[model samples]
Target: MNAKELHDKTPDQLREELSNLKKESFNLRFQQATGQLENPAQIKIARRAAARVKTVLNQKAAAAAATE
Candidate 1:
């Protein structure tokens, strides 16, 4: 998912997306630990995606706070 898509989602949807990304990241780490990970780059990609979602979420929160 891209930042544009994330930015369009409501906070609840963004939270759900973040949760799924975290689960994927955890599973990737477990696979790497067992030496069964075929693509180590996936871990990095997932981490970044999670970070992107977080950045969008924070931006949304800041915008809301500024309006209040």
Candidate 2:
């Protein structure tokens, strides 16, 4: 997903997306181990996507905390 899309998601949704991305990453790794992965680049993509979600989530949390 793109940054714009990620930023648009609410905190709860972002967390859910993060969970799904991590699971996908794990599955990709398993596929790689078994030599069944059609695309090795998927691992990197999933990792970066997860990181983007996390970065945005943190940003939102900090912004909320700062207002208080």
Candidate 3:
């Protein structure tokens, strides 16, 4: 998903997405180890997507904490 779509998702949803992405990343790694992975660059893209979700989640948490 794109940054705009990621930003629009609720925190809980973002967390869920992050978890799923991590799982996918793990699977991708396994595929690579077995020499079955196609488009190895997908690993990097998945990692970046997870990072984006995390960054947004962190920003939201910080904002919430600041308000209280």
Look at candidate 1 and give me any clashing residue pairs.
none
- Cα distance off (Å), candidate 3, residue 47: 0.6
State each model's CA lDDT, in order.
0.96, 0.95, 0.93
Give the TM-score of each candidate. Answer: 0.97, 0.96, 0.94
Model 3: number of backbone collisions: 0
Candidate with top TM-score is 1
lDDT of 2 by residue, 1-68 (tens): 89899888899999999999999999999999999999889999999999999999999999999999
The 10-residue segment of model 2 with minimum total lDDT is 1-10
In candidate 1, position 26 carries an lDDT of 97
User: Per-prediction RMSD in angstroms?
Assistant: 0.5, 0.6, 0.7
Quality of model 1 by C-alpha lDDT = 0.96
Q: How does candidate 3 fare on TM-score?
A: 0.94
Q: lDDT by residue for model 1 over 1-68, one digit each (tens)?
A: 88888888999999999999999999999999999999999999999999999999999999999999
